[model samples]
Target chain A: MVEELIIAGFGGQGVMVMGQILSYAGMHEGKNVSWIPSYGPEMRGGTANCSVVVSDEPIASPIVTEPTTAIVMNRPSLDRFEPMVQPGGLLIYNSSLIDRAPERTDIRVIAVPANELGEEVGSDKVANMVVLGAYIKARGTVSFETVGQCLAEVLPARRHDLIPLNLEALKRGAELVK
Target chain B: MAGRKLFKGNEAVAEAAIRAGCRFFFGYPITPQNEIPEYMSRRLPEVGGTFVQAESEVAAINMVYGAAGAGARVMTSSSSPGISLKQEGISYLAGAQLPCLIVNMVRGGPGLGGIAPAQSDYFQATKGGGHGDYRLIVYAPASVQEMVDLTLGAYDVAERYRIPVMILGDGVLGQMMEPVSFPEGSEPENAPQRPEPEWATRGARGGRAPRIVSSIYLKPEELYKHNLRLQEQFKRAEAAETRYEEVRTDDAEVLLVAYGTTSRVCRSAVEKLRTAGVRAGLFRPITVSPFPYKALGERARQVKAVLTVEMSLGQMVDDVRIAVAGAAPVDFLGTTGGVVPKAADIVERAAALARHGAADQATREGIS
Candidate 1:
């Protein structure tokens, strides 16, 4: 199985951390994965995104032209990436931040209220985790346990104190999407 | 696999240098490659290695010269514009025959182009970015794993040949994260008992004749001889290390040539073309300087046409044309200013070349 994904949001929205966790989870699951961020100047106050792949086969190009799944957490991200989803693919958007809906009918669209779910769980800053949780539950690329462990690994030691809240946020996201 | 984990290419390159026994790092910070110096700053001290964040790129490269002259396994890294600043120092390193690794995680530009990935520096990297007739062993890695492997290999090759070596990557690879591991089993170390090279400067013990590490040959006659000697050594290095990798070429009708990040795109294009029944293949030159010219020339004879792709406007294709040299028709495709070439684009070009390159060329000639 191959899942080419583009996860996008604001710079401080933990978009890069989301990519790192997924890629780390993919690695721990014995899959060939790669994650590349949009590190250009366009990232200043713009949609910060990253391309990630989880595949059973060895990956060739890390650049994703048309992603099989585009998990966008903000309106700018949705506006930019909504058209780049492959036909018959998945488009998961955070309904909390994006007011408008995705117009593409060719692909599956899931609207996850990540910010609302994060606030209910603990903090709204875990909104990125909520969307990531929705992605994993929808795609089933990696196991929930692996993703949790990778989340801990991706975050520094000081952030380890917040694992429980993060896990709860992830669980809320997973349940919301399905 | 015990130590395998996802690492950014720049951080991995720094760690790989440490594992390769590099004792010193000299560098200044730049975007897309800033992690290299940053990682070195934090990690080098832990391993008893010195990390100098030089005031400027010029100072950093010259510091590399000083460390290498003392026979330290040393290195420095920078992006496009910073690398441009270090060109004169690189030339001096070559002129003096000092062995040190230089990592160029190339970003866009003729000037401060962009903090986006590009292979536009191909000409500067393989064909002497500095001045003079000196050459560097340039390795262009296609992946983060290859970045680690080539970085380890680059130091060894540099020391063996007493020449500058460059790991020519791009911002994409440098900023990307992928699972990478150190070489399997324990890598043998350069023991403390390892004898210093005959040319290394050290305290005078037992009154051995002092050796000088100067590139200046005052007399034109001496400079001429030195240039000849440098050329002869380069030829030997070329013979010893001209590496490339070929895939799906056994019955290929069209061949694609690329390196570094673009090579991975071409590899995907090869697979896609095969699915479309084009019989496409990829020829990736791992060592872009001592480029696998003869090997590519031989493979060119087996194909109907050759297409060279790059992130620049046809730099490496100059080398490709030299290698293919009348064997087959050569075509070129490129993107500029950090725009990545798509795999679909490559497939279309290769398919057209395999299907109607000859007929199309003939028809156009007839019409004209």
Candidate 2:
């Protein structure tokens, strides 16, 4: 199976880090994965996005022209990526930021209060981790245990102190989807 | 620890170059490739190498020239416009027969174009952008692992031929992250060394004659002989270094020709075409300068049509036509200004070509 996902959010929302964590976890699970960020000027302060692919087969293209899932973190991201999800695919949006509901009826939609979940777990900065937890619950592309083990690999040693908080956020997200 | 780890393309290339014995890195900051210099700055010091951020692209390339002249494994990286500024220096290095690694992580445009990725530098890179009858062995790697492999291999090639080699990448390849394993350096640090070749510019040793390295020859005959020698070296590289990959082309009715990141998309397109009951394959040129023309033409002669897809306004198509040589009708589908084409569209075109057989541009457009 192949999972082509696009994760988008404002620059400080950890969009790129989320993708990297997933990619690292996917590799730990013995899968081929690739992650490419939107490295244009938008990366400074504006919206940033990344394309991630995890597959049982070798990943052909890292550019996601047709994504199976679009995980949006803000209103702009939701508005931009809501319609791009393929039919019977998934659209995971953060309801804490986006006001309007999704317009696409062809794909599955999940409105997650990622910010609330992150705050409930420990720190609101882990909102991206909250959404990632939900993503893992919905797709099951990589196991949460593997994600927990590989979080240290994706993050630096100094941030290792925050692994427990991030793990709680991932657990809360997975529980929210369940 | 190096068995497998996630790394950004730029950072991975930097570490790989370090492991490959690259002791000196000189470059100016440019968007999409800034991480290269930034990473070098931090890591080079750890390995006892030198990283210099030159004042300008010109100065950076000249610094590369100086380091290479001293028999050091040297490198310089830049984007499109920055690369253009370094053109004169690149030509000078080629003329002087210096060995160095030059990286062009191409961004869009003719001028200061967009910071988004594009392969528009195809002609500039393979066709000799700087000037003179000179050619640099240009490599186009599709993945970050290949980026590591080729970056390490490029230095050896540059030294072996006593010529410059270029790693032609773009924003996507430079900014992306993937799991990669380096050939060496699992211990996190190694002593970077600068090997002095016999022709190095070090002061005449042991009463030997002083070596002078210059690209200038006042006499026309001297320059002509020098040019002939360079041409002979290029021909030898063409025969020895041409590399490509053929994916399911034995019975392919239509062939998709592409390189670098674009080739990965075409690989997916090939699978889509086969699923749609069309016989399609891909020809990926790993070495763009010493392009595998003969191998491509052999495959092209068997196919009904050839579709050349690129991230430019059909630059590589010229070389594609030359290689096909009318064996099959060659068509091009290009998206310029950093717009990457979709695999679905590539599949549609290849399926149409496979169905209609030799669907020229007009005929393919007329199908609908």
Candidate 3:
């Protein structure tokens, strides 16, 4: 089965990084994977997004017009992407930034107070990890252990000192579903 | 050997150059192609190679000229406008018969166009970018993995031909991430060492005088002979290097011809046509110059019609017409200024061409 996900937000919100982490984990698990970002001026201060496809078969188009899952980090992202999520798909939104809830009943909407969770975990930057945690808990496309390992490999390369805090944020967010 | 790693196309090209034994890189920063220089900056030093961000594209390409003159495997990269600035240097390198790799990760253009991907530079690349009769072997890569493979092949072709080669790609191909295999072993041992240039400005040895390399020939006859020699080299390249791919064209009634990213779109179009029971196929030219004329000419003799798709208004379409040589009717479909045509549009265009062909045949029968 093909599992397609889109991560979108402002340029600096780590939305692209979240997609990269998932793509890395998918590759690490030996699944066929592809990561494609919108290039050119769209990547400036404007909204930016990336499509990640993980599948048992070869991927046809790396550009996903309809995604099965979406992680919206901001209000603009939610408004832009909410209509494109497939039926019965999952959407994890950062409720701290996105004030409106999704209007659709055909999909699963998980609103995580990602920024507040990050603040509770001692950093506001780990909000992406919090949203990622809620996504895993909701969909189970990838195991929490694999995501943790991906986090260990990718996060330290960018921010070595924030790993433990980000890990804590992930666990806290994941436990919210339980 | 079986593992995967995430890499942008620009980074993949840089790494592939290193694996191909390119020891010197000179480039300036420009949108879409900046990653190439950045990758070279971080990776060159680790490999004990040289990477320099020159002050301008002009300077960068001349530095490539200097390095290539010294018998070193070298490369230079830029985007559309920057590549225009380097045209003079490229022409000189071509005139001097220097072997080097030049990369253009193309962005939209005319002036300082937006940083979106475009294929508008096809004419500049395939038709001798500068004011001379010289040609650089130009390769258009569709994906990030082919970006690596083509970059490596470009260097090898340049060395083999003793002429400059260009890797012509769009920004989407430059920025997308894909898995690439890092080739095993150190650099190949059998590459021809840069010949000691009697024409290079190497430091004077003992009593020997410094050498000079220039393309300026004042005498009209002398310059004419130089042009003829360049033409001869181009002919050799034409005979030796035409690379292309023909997909399911055996019984194809309509040929969807394209290159680079446009070729990928045409592949999807062909699949759509197939599902609809239309006999459509794709012909993709990997080497733009050394233009694959013979292959297209042969296909034209068999196909009823050909549709040329490109991101530009119709640059390669002109080449396609020339290749077909009146053997078949050639049609053109294109998008410009960074707009990419969707697969559905291409398929629809192909279907229209098929209907037009059938109508034309019916008219011929009515006349008979």
Candidate 4:
């Protein structure tokens, strides 16, 4: 099976990092994965997005024009990616920031109050992690345990102190989705 | 456990070049490819190698020439416009028969184009952008893993032929991150020393004659002989280094010919075509210069039509047509100015080509 996604948000919202973490989780589960950011000038502000592909077999293209899933953490992201989700696919957005709901009726849309939940978990810095947790719950593409293990691999030793907080964020967000 | 680590394509290439015993890197900063030199700058110092962010692309390539001349494995990388700036030096290196790695993380270009990815440099890379009759062996990697493998392999190919080798990647490949594993026993921290070349400009010893690394021949006849020698070397490389990947081409009614980023899209397209009951296959040339013409020619004999898909207007299509040699009608589908064609569209175009055999070449519209 293959799951293609776009994770989009502001430059500081950890959109690329979320995509990378998901890719790492896919790798931890012994799957082929790729993460391609919208680099250059587009990455300067709220237009930051990354395309991610996770597959049982070799991944062909890292690009996803029509993603099966979209994790939009801001309103601009919601505006940009809501319609691009394939029919019957998932659109997980941060409801704390986006006011308007996705207009598409053909897709599954999950409105997670990611910022509120991130604050509830400990820090608003983990907002992307909260969205990621919801993404894991909604898609089940990679296990939470695999994501935690991937965190160990991705987080530098100097930043190891934050792993528990991030893990708490992941768990709390997943609990919200449940 | 699988030996895998996540890496951005440019960073992976830098680490792989280190693993390949490249002790020197000289490059200028360019978007979509800056990570290469940035990684090298950090890592090379720890390994006792050199990383110089030269003043300009011209200076950087000349430094590569100097380093390669001293028998050191060296590399330089840049985006399309920067790469164009280094053409004069590249031609000089080619003429002098120096071995070095040059990376072109191609961006959209005619002059300082946008930092978005494109394969518009196809002609500039494969058709010898520099003056004089010479060709640099070009490797087009579709994945980050291939980015690592081909970066390492490019050094070997360069050294084997005493010529410059190019890794022609687009911004898409350079900026992407993927899981990759280097070869077994290729630890980058303490890379093994590569043997110094006998022809290197090392200080003369043991009463041996001093070697001259010169590309200038005063006489026309002498220059003609030198050109012939270079051509012979190129021919040898063509015979030995024509690498390609053919997927599901045995009974395909249509063949999609692509390289680099475009090839990856075509691979996805092939899967879609199969689901739609279309007999489509892909012929991806790993070496863009020694371009798997023979293999493509053989596949062309079996396929009803050949569709050349690229991120450019249609540069590589000329080579595809030459390889197909009228065995099958050749068609083209591509974009330019950094707009990438979608895989679904590639499938649709190929399927139409499969059904209709071949449409008029002039009727094909460029995907914006």
Best by DockQ: 4
RMSD of each: 2.1, 2.7, 3.3, 3.4
Per-residue lDDT of model 3, residues B137-244, tens digit only: 999988777887777777668867778999999877787786666655534343445556455566778889766666888999999998898888888888988899
Going through the candidates in order, the fraction of native interface contacts each one reproduces equals 0.76, 0.80, 0.37, 0.78
TM-score of chain A considered alone, across all candidate predictions: 0.96, 0.97, 0.92, 0.95
Pitting candidate 1 against candidate 2, the one with the higher TM-score is 1
Candidate 1: where are CA atoms >4 Å away? A42-45, B184-193, B358-368
The CAPRI class of candidate 4 is medium
lDDT of each residue in A40-77, candidate 1, tens digit only: 76554676899999999999888899899998988988
Indicate the worst ten consecutive residues by lDDT in candidate 3 chain A: A56-65
Question: Candidate 2: deviation at residue B22, Å?
Answer: 0.7
Interface RMSD values, listed in order for every candidate: 1.1, 1.9, 2.5, 1.0
Model 3, clash count?
Answer: 0
- Per-residue lDDT, model 4, residue B130, is 93
DockQ for every model comes to 0.77, 0.71, 0.41, 0.80
Error of 2 at B109 (Å): 0.6
Ranking by DockQ, best first? 4, 1, 2, 3
- Among incorrect, acceptable, medium and high, the docking class of model 1 is medium
Per residue, candidate 3 scores C-alpha lDDT tens digits across A78-111 of 9989999989988888899888888989998888
Question: Poorest 10 consecutive residues of model 4 chain B by lDDT?
Answer: B359-368
